[model samples]
Every structure is written in structure tokens, then in C-alpha cells.
Target: MFTSGTRQLLAKSNKLCLKSGSYLKTFSAKFTTCDLYALVEPTEPKVVTENSPGPNSLKIQAEISNFQDIRPMIFSTGIPFSSSFISSLPFCENSFSQISSIPLGYNHHAILDVCSSPEMVLSLANRPSLTLLPPTNWADKLQNIHMKVAPKGLTNVFNTVDGSSANDLAFKAAFIAYKEMRGLPDELSEQELSTSMDNASPGSPDLSILSFRNGFHGRTMSTLSATRTKPIHKVGIPAFKWPAVDFPQLRYPLEKFEKENAAEEKRCLDQVEHIIKTSKTPIAGLIVEPIPSEGGDLHASNQFFQKLRKITKDNGVVMIVDEVQTGVGATGKFWAHEYWELDTPPEIVTFSKKMQAAGFYHQAQLRPKIPMRQFNTWMGDPSRTLIAGAIISEIESQSLVEKTKATGDYLMSHLKPISIRYNKLVQNVRGKGTLVAFDCPTPEYRDMFVSLMRSEGVLIYACGNRSVRFRPALIFSKSHVNVFLPRFESVLNKMYKQLWS
Candidate 1:
């Protein structure tokens, strides 16, 4: 039930387009707001250019290459607009390409309304140094927004710049807490104070965070050490000697291979416990993604995660579940770790991506005793936090999390049959909620699949060696799934015919 003011606010921005073919038709309607996106989004994707880059995109790439690296640039979108499609020309995208960062779809009316508010203006204009001078409502905002969805058993939030910084700070907090647990004096000793400036141990200790193989945290100095997805991300970068453990590699269909998958998970869990017990450098914290997004969208059973949590607890290693990609509502549960149902929750859970704000939630114990250790300039942007608040509100009001679960189930029902039909091309279909993925026969095929999907105007992307990951926004509904499946099968059919030829 929208209030009069809320109705007025939505009505002001309700004059959106219903794109048909290449033409966008204007319609003015009073929406119930339950399915606000269908009114705002294009009916279907439209690709004007024969090639993905086309002429306009290539020209922009050439211009950008003069001062920036455009090697990573696939194509340029046209005029920015609301809905998943950022542009009105060249093509419209059902975006998952930006690494699942677009939370409530692009330029959603709710977000737009937030942007136009006095609160947003003040946040942008002031941009205060939060550590020294946080807004008066700072505490209230955090409690109302972040705490509203804080993972069960976690009560504190530490805001940072992005996922990488969030993990980095979490690591620091773990280290500080680790030393404090050893009954070290709160105040630094003379030797500890002097050695710190020289970047030596005792102060700048050789402590490390344990991360899994193919797990990616971030690219910051400390986080780069913990990331293990690709050598390309770590090559030539100096890294700490952090121990890397094997994440469970389960076979799919998970039901058919239950016994073997159980054995594999047990093997990995054994290795994790072994490493934590015997690492030469003290493993102060262990970080893991509930689903390793960049690492082929891998998954382990709830039992496996529970055992892993128990291992971390028994071994006295701080458990930091890195939910940078899997957090928010994408994974059915608002926090994916909720699936584990750990007897004692993980000490720290870091987040970014869809949440729109970057930070970690932890038990109060992880807060460093000494001040200025985990400090940063602009500790976090209030504007982004405000946006995050709006995102949460929209997610709650529309029951997007539950909807995502239903959509994911809908998507899987289609993908599983397609995988069987194209067994040579598609394998290992797996996902939770809308964060789904499938593996191609090879890296080349996966890349080709992504390229063709983009040409078909669905901007999907790949991960790991040969997996195509689908990262749809929370508003992705059954109608969107219907649009996606035919295009998906068309590409598969085309690829399969070509393979035989």
C-alpha cells in the first residue's frame, strides 16, 4: 500500500518506455508497484549492431585507448537510462557482465527517487570524512539498513571502499584480535613500536589469512596475497606467504553423484583442518566464499560448510566468510551463509557487490582494541550507504529474495534439460537462486558462448576455465527468464550444428 506521497513520487517517474524491436513506445500507467520493472524495462533485448563492438562502440574504445587500457572493454552502451539496459542504441542488456554489481537493476525509480532526495544531495555535497565527522544519523542509518539484514549472530559492521578493502580490514581485525587473545598488552611496547616502522615482525607481523584455491578476495596489497583464482591477477605483485587450501570440487548432478561428492567434500575438509593445524605462519583468519563466484561458481553442501565451520571453531582460527559476490539476496537467503546454519556463526562476513555498499559484519569481539589500526579516509561513502538502504527497502518491499529463489528454480528447470540435449557442449549445470552457471566443453566454447550471447543482446559473462555464469538482477522475473531461454537455446542450437559441420 503506497502512501499518497510515495504514489506521487513513483508517478513522477512512471512515464517509462516499453521497447518493441528497436522502437521504444511511451506509456503512462499507474502501476501497482509490485511489478514495477516490467513497466520500466524493455520488452526484450535489441541489438542494432551486427558485431558486438559495432562502429560507435569501437570509436569510443579507440578514444578511450588513448589514455586508458581498452583491452577489457567489450562494447560501449549508448545513453544511460533506467532498467537493465543502460542504453537506447546499439543494444539493450540484461546485464550480468558488470560482475553482478547492479542490484535493483539500473536507474530503478526507487533509486532515482533516492537520488533526487535532499538526503542524497547532502551526502554527495558534503562527503564528510566519516571517521572524524560522521553524519548525525550515521548510527541510525546503519542500524536501520545494514543491521536489518545482518547475518544471524553478527552484530557489528565495518564499512570500507569495496570488497577487497572489506576483506583486508577483516584480516586486520582478525590479526589484532588474534594477538589480543594471546594476552598481549593493549599498549604497544617500545620494541614493538620501533619495529613497526621498519615493517618487521612483532608489530608488522608475518601473520596470514588462509584462503581457498580459486577464491578471489580483492586486488589490494594484502588481499592480493589471499586471492588465488588466476596467476594473471597475482603475477608480478608481491604477496604474503599465505597458505592456500583446496576447496571442494563436487561432481554434478549433485544427487546422482552424492556418495562421490561426499567423499570429495570430506577430503577437502580434512585438508583444511590439516593446513590450519600445521601452517608454518600462524593462520589468523580463514576466508571463504559461500559460492566462489570467480572460481567457476563452485558449491559445497550445507553439511560440508557446517563441518568447515566447526573445524575453524575448534582450531581457534577466525572464520571470515567472504560474501562479496554471494551476499544480499541473490543466493535465495539474504546472506548465503544462512544456509550453513552454523551452531556458532562465522566470526566475520564481508560483503559488497549487490549490497551497493562495501563492508564486513562481525561479532563485537573482532573490533580492534587499538584505534586507528583499521582506519581509512572516507571510511565509507554515505551516498553509497544511502543507496544500499534504498536497495534493501526495495528488496524487502517486493520480496525480491523469495522471488529470486523461484526464478532460479525456473531457470534450472530449463538449463538441466538443455544440458542433457547438448551434453557435448554444456556440463555441470549448477547454481543457487539466480546466481546460476554452466560449463562449456572448453574455454574457447565458453568464450564463444559469451560473445554470441552478447551479440544476441544478453550481456552474460564467464568465470573459471569454462563456465558461463548468469548473474541477473534481483528483479529478474519469469517473463525475463522466458525471454532468456529461447535466445540461450538458439545459441546452443547454432553452436551444436556448427560443431557437427
Candidate 2:
């Protein structure tokens, strides 16, 4: 897969390349990648067969192929994906997103209570076109639910169906804001109007959102242009000629390489400034993931992000922080970028995943001045908003964010020593809260370790090319960590001994 030089270069990973970037095109979502958290829990992984996707699972997959694409999870069974109950099979599920977007785990009590409510039943039964038909309490839903955990400084919200749609909504808001800031009229000129009708601009204006190398935003045409993580998601689709710059590949044990990492951040910032200044398609916005999870759980310092805020402010580019993966309490903070302490918050913050509701929150001005400019049929389901509200209530009352911080510290502390003990097998063990990940010596070893752990009854996942990522639910505790760690260590020991030889 690589020249010796290429292998050695990735081993160091000094600068993350954008196009043709080094990404793991993991064959199965169940087997590879990040964020798409697989939430298996409470019980240990159960494995009845020597090989996963054993005969029974393969037969189930074959049935799926009659109507759907089953190549990705060719051996998946619905049982492992259920958040309601532990898999009857030998492996504890990673609690990953299958058909399940379980908040607290599979069928969390709080979530179940909400879903069982008579009010919830009514809401579900009478689903309306939120944009066309009216929900009298819709504004109330946004205020009481989303605003409760709303990213700092954002006041307006536009809801969508999923993370990808959330991002597309954010991109549109940013582009519209960019044009408004340019003092363009809502009513276009004859040329602008006519050209836009034909999908050209001054109407469809040549504007771009600057993304980083290995940043995965979404699968939509426009947002996909801002996505630079892996080619498979974007292949055969015509991408907007948007500019993407390097995402910093800062060294791990960040405190250990302060000077070096700081220099890397500076280099990336310089590239960002250069692209914003020179790209022929005027840069309308800049989108960033707090951790770049799908790419490899890669992280940059708070200082790096703060500097990005300042730069976008100076350049008049709308700064959109894509928190679809890192939002909620997963990163110890309700919003991961909260650690950045930027004097100004990102102009727009998009969220999904754990929120269970999908949308972007923005400052008042980013709201389109014109009607019908930013809209969809069902603006977002109120039922999902109710679920999000319940999730919020649970997280706040439980103090899950603070608890996750403490638990994550405990987890990371334990992992560091293991990373050192099995130094050849793993390295760069890094995390914030329970959102932790570590790199294996190679992709083969990484996959083997993940599979081995599941066999031993501890389900986890792989991300990027060489990192194993942990994205358990907010309920995961030090107690759960205690249960998982010994199992993880056992698998690591066995894998190191057997595979290293």
C-alpha cells in the first residue's frame, strides 16, 4: 500500500495532507471509522463463533442484499445493533450506530419514558410539514430543548433530519450570510436571477467553504466538497471546487511537544490564511470538526482553534464548527470547542449524533433575511426534539459531563501506562473525556486488535488508519471502565504476544 518512504512519513505524520490524504477506507462501518459510535454496553461482548459474521450472520446479510447494499456490513445481524438488550451472541456490542441511535445505551429508561408518553405518541402520529404546516409550540420546543444545551453564543437554529443535513443547512446559512455581508440585495438583478435559474452565478455565486485535510463534514454535494477525509464518500460525485488546507498533525502527549506542536499549528494557520486570501472562489465560510474524528480522532490545541476564530473574524469569513460528532457531553464539555475559550464563538455550530435532533445554531444575523432562502419540508421532527430534550434533562440532572471528565481522566491515565507497556503495539494514546483514541503500529494490527477485543467480550471500534477510538455513551463510568480495561489489556497482551511474533 505504500513505498517505504510513504510508510515512514505517515509514521511521523508531521503534516496532514488534504487531497489523496492517508485515510483508512475501512470496508465496514462496523469495522472501521469514527463518530458513528457503536453503543454496546453493560454486558461484555459475546462471540459464539471463531469468526465474526459467522455462517448465520452471513446468511442474514445475503437476505439484505436482495433489496439493499450489504457490502459494508456483509454479516451484520440486528441483535448486536440493538440498544435495547445485549446481544445474545458471544460479543458485547460497541453500542455503535446501526439502526439504533440509542442515547443512554440501547433503550435508555429516560428515552423510553419519553417515547412512551401520550404526548409523544400524538406528536408522532400527527407529523406535519414543519415548514408549511404549523406546530404552535415549535418555537417553545427550540427554546426549552435545544437552547438548554445550545453552543455558547448561538441563538437561532434550523433543524434537519441528520448530521449531513445539519451541515448542509449550516453551509447554506454561511453562504447567505457571506452574500448579505457583501451588501448584496435579496432581490437579485436580472442577470443574477436568470443565471441562478441555470445554476450559475452571480446568482449561484462562486463561493466556497474552506475545510481542512481529513475533515469529514457530510455526504451532500456541497458539504461533501468541504469533506476531505476519504475518497469513497465523495467518489463519482462532482465536488464544488472548494479549497482545503492542511489540518495540523500535532504530536501526542501534547504537553511533551509544546514547541513542535505550536509550530505545526502556526504552519496550518498560515495555510488557512493563504487559502482564504487567494482562492479564486471567494471563501464564504470555514468549517472545522473539533477533533476531526472520522479522519483519525486527530486533535489540535485550544490555542490553534482560538487563532482560527481570530483569523476568520479578521477575514470576514463565517466560521462554522461542525460538532455533529463531538457535541453533547462526549468531550467532557457539552461542546468540545468550549475548551478553546475563544473571545468570539464560531458563527454557526452544527450538531447531531447524541443530540438525536439535527440542526445548526447560529447568531441572529446568519438567519436568512429573505423567506424561503433556507428551508425544507419538515424542518425537523418535534418528536426528535422531545427526545433531545429528554436527553438534555438526563445529562444535566446526572451531571454526566463532569462525571465523564473524571472518568475519562481515569481511563486515559490507565491507557497511557498500557500504551507504554505495549509500546510497540500502540502509541500516541490521546483523549478528552471519554472521547479517546490510540494508534496501532499498523492498520492490520489495529483491525486485529479490535476483532480480538470483541471476541473477548469488549466491543470497541477503529478510526482513521491506525487508531482505535472509544466513544461510549454518557452513562459509561469508571466502573464500566474497570470492566472494560482488564478485558482490553488481556486482548492487548494476547495480540501483542501472538501477532508481534
The C-alpha TM-scores of every prediction are: 0.91, 0.88
Q: Following a full C-alpha superposition, what root-mean-square deviation does model 1 have from the true structure?
A: 4.8
Q: What TM-score does candidate 2 reach? A: 0.88
Off by over 4 Å in 1: 1-40, 79-92, 95-97, 181-187
Among these predictions, the greatest lDDT belongs to 1
